[model samples]
Structure formats: C-alpha cells, structure tokens
Target: MDVFHVTDKDGNKITNEKVIDYIQQSLGTNACLLPSLRRTVGVKAASKHTAIELTGTDRPGLLSEVFAVLTDLKCNVVGAEVWTHNMRVASVVYVTDDSTGAPVDNPERLSMIKVQLCNVLKGDNDKRVAKTVVSTGVTHTERRLHQMMFADRDYERVHNGLLESRDDKFRPLVTLQNCVEKGYSVINIKSKDRSKLLFDTVCTLTDMQYVVFHGTVDSDGPDAFQEYYIRHMDGCPVNSEAERQRIIHCLEAAIERRVSEGLRLELCSGDRTGFLSDVTRIFRENGLSVTRAEVSTRADKAVGVFYVTDAAGNPVHAKTIEAVRGEIGQTILQVKESYSKSPSEETGGRFSFGNILKSTSERFLYNLGLTKSLP
Candidate 1:
C-alpha cells in the first residue's frame, strides 16, 4: 500500500497522505498515480528538465521515440512503468526539467507539449487528448464570487497574464449557487462542434455532458462563440478498491458522528468509491442504520444525495451535517474533488485540471476498447 498526498495546481495541500494503491490500481495502471506526486512538487519549484514518470498505451518503439523527444527537449528520464492491457501498452516515465524551469503554463506551450508527447507515443493520428487548466482564486466574500461569475475570459487572461487567451465573452452562465440548487449547470460545450475547440477540449477532459448553448463566428478577425459545459453524470464507475476504501472511511465517519447525536446525514454528492460502505460502517459503528438513501456519480464527480434516517426514516440534525463536512472533504472527497469542487453538490461543475486529464485518459481507453478488460 502506497501513501500519497494530493495538492492543487498552485501547490496548496488538499488531502493528507493515505494508502491509495486501490485508487491507483483502479486507474488500470499503477503508474496512473505518478502525476499526483509530480503535481505536488510545485510548478514554481524551479528545476532543470527533471526526470518524469510516463504511463499510457504502448505502441511500437513508443519508449524509444518518447525518450528521443525528451532528449531533444533536454528532459531527464528517471523512472518508468510499462505494461500491456487490452492490447495497448502503458508506460510511466519520470523526466527531469521541463525546459522553462517548469512545465510552462501557457496554453500554446502546454498544447504543444501535449501534441509532441502524443505524436511520439501515439503517432500522427486524431487521438483525442483533453487538457483542463484550473487556477484557484480564494474568495472569502460573496462579492468576489460575483466578480468571478461576471469576469470575461479575456479579462481573466489579462489579469492572469495568459499569452494564449480564451475569448473574453465566454463565461459560465450558471453560478456555483445555481449549480448546487439546480443539480446541473446551464452552460456547456458541444463535443460535436468544431468551432468550440477549447470548450470541447474541456468537456472531453472533464467528461462533461454538455448541451450546446450557442455559437457564432465573426465575418472579420477572430471568431466569437460561447457555450456552457454541464456535467450530467460521472462517466466512470467506482470499480477500484482504493476509491472504495476512501468512500467507506468518509461515509462511515459521517454516519458514526451523526448517530451519536441521534440523527441522519442528508447526503447530496454524486456516486463515489466507498460511499455506501463507509456510510453503513459509520452507522453500524455507532449502533445506527441508514433507513433510505440515494447516491451516485455525475460526470466523473462523486455525489451522494441521501436522506439518511434511523432504521425507520427520520431527519438527521443540521448539527450532525456540520460536524462531518470537514471529515468528508478530507477523505472520500479527495479523489472526487481533486482540485475541483468539494465532493458535494454545493460545488458542482468545477474541478481541478488533473481530474480532467484523468477523465480524458479513461475516456480515451474506453473509446479505444482498452479498458474493457478492467472489470
């Protein structure tokens, strides 16, 4: 059992280190967890191109080709994991130094790196790879929320100094408050449209099910388009033992803490790893039982909106919920949230960039018939 700590893009600690081999194995490749460690290293931590771990479907001479490219980029190869699953080869390589002190956050640079890596690993083909970039901004007040809601993407770029900026007009129509209350967002990207390049990339990476809201192209200069991306359901299932453990720990703790007070928990998160098991354990530990519940995943995010009761259905106290929120976020929510929103309906349609990448990898394998052997 390997323990790992999860962090945000800006090097903020999100979850404590815990044994998560089950989660890594659930990823269909133990190497899938490599990026988690790299991310924690902090992008701002300056280093020459250092060795990095790489893992994915393997092709002929894929390793050699990738190494060749790494050599050209002056990156070091420190570690690797290569295996074949469902007729695809997956490899993990640890490279040092990302040329620009760290992997450049510039959109074009990131895209170029992805393309270069993919070309070497996958060759010249329309293999779909989605990349999501999420930058967290702390808003201790509601006024800040309003600003984020209304801020244009270009304004965001200018503020953030993004060289390859997205359209200024594009904005998430629904606010976080709206998402929680509505159980869905009104904005989203259309996977079928070619014009919504960035939005489509985000949707694919995040595994969002978006209904095309609107689109337009300018007769002169750059085109203008806006579409909202909404998450309908978490595309993958909690088939991994690791996710199951975390879920169980969180739910059980929540239930146990609540039962001591003679109440139930009203869960409003999506499907997750050990949700039911954890909830049940907590109830059992505290001499309680869940009367009725509803839990599930929405678009790669975990949620469990359950009206917990005693053996007989009864309302849980508000205090019980308040008591358990911290624990829930600390454990089960780590994989679900992953720099995105908390693993609750309160923060939906928002997620970390790495989660989006993981989703894209899963989608790619599933679409290509590689994950069929997972179950």
Candidate 2:
C-alpha cells in the first residue's frame, strides 16, 4: 500500500506525496528502488459485481492514468490507501467493473484485459514492452461448488463444499448463449467448420439477450475456430460469491453439454497452443484422466474440451470456461443486466477472444521475462 503526497505553497498537507512520485516514475522516469525504501498505497473500489486492488512502487501523477484505465474499463474506484518511504512508493487500488468480467471464463480474454492495464502503466503500445500475468486456476470441485453458490436457490450455504471438494479439477469451456431472444441459425455448423461464419453466429446469438450489443474475436483461426468477445453493460450480477460459482457451474454444464453433442456448432475457438497442453498438464497434475478431447485452435488462444474425469483437470479450470464462469457468474450476469437496462450506450472496440488477449498480451508477459532481451 503506497502513494504520493504533496503540499501547497501555504505549507498545508495536500495529497499523499508517494502517489505523486509513483505517477512521475510511471511517466518514464527512473523507478529504481533502494532495499530499505518502500512506499505503500491502498485503493478500494466496489461496484455491484467487481473489485480492484493495486499496490506497487511509488511515483507522481500515477492516479490520473490509473483512473483513466479504470474509466476506460468503466470501473468505479471506491477506496484507496497510499504511502511512500525513502523514494519508493506503493498503492493498492480497488475497483469494480462487470465489463472486465464479461469473459471471466476465458483465460486469454481475462489475461488480455489485465495486460492492457499494465501496458498503460509501461507507456507502450508496441508488443515488446508488455506486462506479465499472474493467475490461479480453479479445480472442478471448486467449480461445482461455485455453481451451487450462485444457483439462486434457498440453500445458499452448500457452496462452501468447495473446500472439501478441493480435489476435483477440470478444463472445460462454458458459453452463456441465451437463444431465447436472438435466434442465431449458425448452431448448425461446428466452430471449426467456418471461423467467420461461426463467430458471426455466436455474436448474434449473445445479442439475442439484448444485453450484449458488442462482440469481438480473439482466436488465431479467423477461418477455423470459435470467437470469444466481451459484452458491455451497466450493473453487475449478484455480489454473493456462492451464487456466482453456482451459476458458473450451470453455464459450464450447459455449454459443454450443448457443444459436445456435435449437433451444437459451438466449438471452442482460438488456436491449439499451450492452452490444451496446459489443460492436459493440469489433468495430469491433479491425477485426472483425459478420456477424450475435441481440441482445436487458430492462434495463441485455444479451446480444448476434454472428457476429463479427475482432479488433474481441477487447476486448469481457470483456463477453461467452466472454472471462470463457475467462480464469477453472478458478476457476469450483472453486466448483462446492466446492458439490458440501457440499450442506448455507445459501443467500444470489438475484438475476438484472441484479439482481446493479443491486444494486451498479459498471458505472454511472463514468458517475455524468459525471452531474450530486445536488441
């Protein structure tokens, strides 16, 4: 928790000095730090569906850009803690935004948004200077518990069973397609059959809810895989974590059951990169067996719905739609509801699942550290 502090000409304590310092350093100044010097700042923001907490080195004018990114994501800042010590500064920012939570189940999509925010800090749009990603995937048992939690049922406490089910893990995609309003006919083809055809189909399908007016694609195969995008809205789903998880599980079950039938063209889009590999590893890591899989992808993003039957797939849940949705379904629902309330809002940039991640590159940021230094 760090921030910058300042004073007016009259000598009255103005803003926190560290927050100002961090802002200056982030603007391309030397943010190098000494061992003993540390600055801390804490920011707390809460909306109906999301929360943000940011902490790091202290500098000047940092709040402006931080707020800008939040503004861009339409996040509301609720609280903050700022501090600095010996030229070092740190801040913890709290925010809540359902839009950022739109594709919470898609790893690449979530990673991309975070990476974009980090890039805004690094002062670079170029691919080279991107930020890294730190993630914690969930387990299948965890996902199931999450589903139960957000189920909107009377027995709200059962969601806590996730702790006992700590061993069940899975990597499954869960697409929340409400076909009730928007009647998309593209369900006739496999996601891999026609990339553009399937994408347009999925976008239109979500649009049926009327809550989703904007959509984009992020998969490498514009001609092969499925499309992943975020829908913007005003409010968020319920604030209950239990309800959130339950809804996710339901969505995952629904999407997986729908697509696996082969009759459902909703194939997991994106490329066949390390995503499948990671899913497999998680399955193996948790002692789960991947009985079978219809895996495919077109870019760095990928989709591999495995018929996994064990804990090995648990941690990989984050990589799969099941886990993401299971963990944060209520928030996603809120975003949908918010959009439904205001049908007149302006649309932002549209992206595919892969483009969203590629737009920011948060997933690749960590890999960049292992990469050779640029010339």
Candidate 3:
C-alpha cells in the first residue's frame, strides 16, 4: 500500500534521487502515479462489422469483461487488439452477428452491446459481475496470469477454445501469394483459432508497420481460416519469397502458441506507478511478446492476464515459461520487498507516461508491469 515513485519532467521513472532532484530543481514537476477512472466505451462501424473501442484506467480482468459483454450480446469477435500505457488502456475489437455470421448492422443491438459494456466496465451491480478469480495460496502475480487463461466465465468459448481440442496430428498451415493485379499480397493462414488469433496476426503485421487494406476471418468450430490483403507502408505487395516466408513464419508461430496450454502469465499486486512498464519490460528483455493482456484491480490487488510467446513469435514451452515467470516474479517481489528497505527513495520504482509510445520497443514495454512497490 505504500507505493512511492519519482518522475522526471518527461514522466520517466527515476531510479535514483539525483535524477529526481535535478528534474525538480531544473524542470519543475511530472506525474508519479496513475489514478483509476470510470470506464469509457466507444463504438463505430468498420468495413462491414462493428468496431468497439474501450479506454479507461488499467485493471485486471478488464479484457475478459469486455469480451464477456460481447458474448452476452451474441457477438462473435473476428478481430481485436489492446494496448496499455501506464495505467491507461485502449482496445479495439471487431465483432459480427453471431447468428448471421456477418458484420453487425443493427443499431439497436450495437447500442445494447455498448450499454452493457459500460455497465461491466463501470462495475455496475445492476448488470452482472464477473466471478472473482481466486485461488488457495496463489500469489498476486499468478492471479494476474491466471485471468489470461481462465479469465471470466465463458472465456474458453469466447476464445474459440482451440488450444485443447486439436487434431492428433495437426500442424499449422501457412501460405502467402501475391495478387499483383490487385496490388496487394494475399496471405492465407489455417490454424486452430485460439484466443486473439486475429489480434495476434493482425497485430504482428501492424507491428511491422504494414497496412491491412482488406481481410476475412472465418472459423468452423475451433479451426479458423483467415486471409488478409496486406501491403507494406508504401503500398507495395510483399513479393520477395523470403519476406513472404518471414510473415508466414511469424503468423503461424503466433497461431500455434494460442493452444500451448501453459501460455498464461498473471500479475496480482497492489496497483503502483509504472506498473505496466516494469512488467512488460520482462517480456521484452526475455524475447517474449504479449499477444493478449487484461488488467484490473480488486481489493487493492492488481490482477492481470497475458498470453505470451517466445522470440520466434511462438508460445514458449514449459521450460522457457518457467524462466519468464521467475524473472517477472522476482522483479515484482523486489518491488514489494523494497517498500521497507528503500525508505530514502521517494518513489521506489516509478516511471512516467505521456503520448502512446510510437516506437516498437517502447510499445512493447509501455504496454506492460506491476508489483508491491512503486516501480
């Protein structure tokens, strides 16, 4: 509960007092912590589907709750992506009509979905509450990771539950073809649709700074087949064989990771300044990438969920995940254990935030940390 952090004028977390003192004496002041705010949900029409955007203070289970509301509305998520900076988060999800298998077009249904999301985001008792995710003797960090795996009720169904139910001799199938006449590249990916399949694939392309002009996602039961028409930032098709293979490799790897039974990381701790940054840094430093993440706060405990993968953009096996778990857990333990050990430090391990980070590295790191201490 005693989370203190120092911030330079640019909002960077200062590890030593010398930096903080200099900032204060020469540059004035900056932010030290992130305060929670009431949730805000925005919706729009995208292509032929519904695009829903959410923004608010960061909290554990937030992503799960958002998808839960969509499920209740009988909406099928075709694409979704989320980013958390500091404690502020913004996410966009593309959904379609569950029964019709087409983009949502009814205004009434969209409005209802929006209203229900507001209720859940605001923690309104009148609507419904997600069952509290708890465990016997489970630490806060594990709790956050568990939310990504178990998440809210219906999470498995929501994510299409392809991880556990796959062909006995199944393998990811990926191919890329150029449609020069259309001036775009057609990438066909076939894989068991795990949680965030669309998000992960699309996020990878977007992360590469490519533009997706058109795409289609379809799933028969747990297996999903998706095709995307993409081009480089300059609108050039990816014609090089090596480049196409690279894209396929990264996407195929991501899709396969979704089913890697143990690809979940949880963080349960008191919310603190620069929480997201510190946690995600572990992922980056370890060559891990977060495909999906959800965060929320309950009873002063930060509960977060993340689906992660290794350097090749595939989920790590058990051994690698263990190392990732240890590094992150120790980092958080250091924060909490330092509360009493570092009294002279005004802010134990706090950082600052401004605009949504534009760089890939900062984007990778800005989107994540949380522990007992301020940093």
Model number with the top TM-score = 3
- Point out the higher-scoring one by TM-score: 1 or 2: 1
Per-residue lDDT over 94-143 for candidate 3, one digit per residue giving the tens place of the 0 to 100 score: 67676776767676776787777766665633232322111112112211
Which is better, 1 or 2, measured by lDDT?
1
TM-score, candidate 3, is 0.31
lDDT of each: 0.31, 0.30, 0.50
Per-model TM values vs. the true structure = 0.23, 0.21, 0.31
Sliding window of 10 residues with minimal summed lDDT for model 2: 337-346
Cα deviation of 78, candidate 2, in Å: 2.9
Error of 1 at 34 (Å): 9.9
lDDT of 2 by residue, 112-165 (tens): 546655655445322223234342222121122122222212122233344212
Ranking by TM-score: 3, 1, 2
Give per-residue CA lDDT, model 1, range 1-375, as digits (tens).
211223333334434333244334444553321111211111111132222223333233444465566555554333232322111233333344434334334445444445566555445652433222223222111122111111211111122243423222322221111134324332322111112233223322232222322222111112222223233345223334554343333222211111111232444444433343444444443333332222343455444432233333234444544444554543442211111111122333221222121333334435554334432
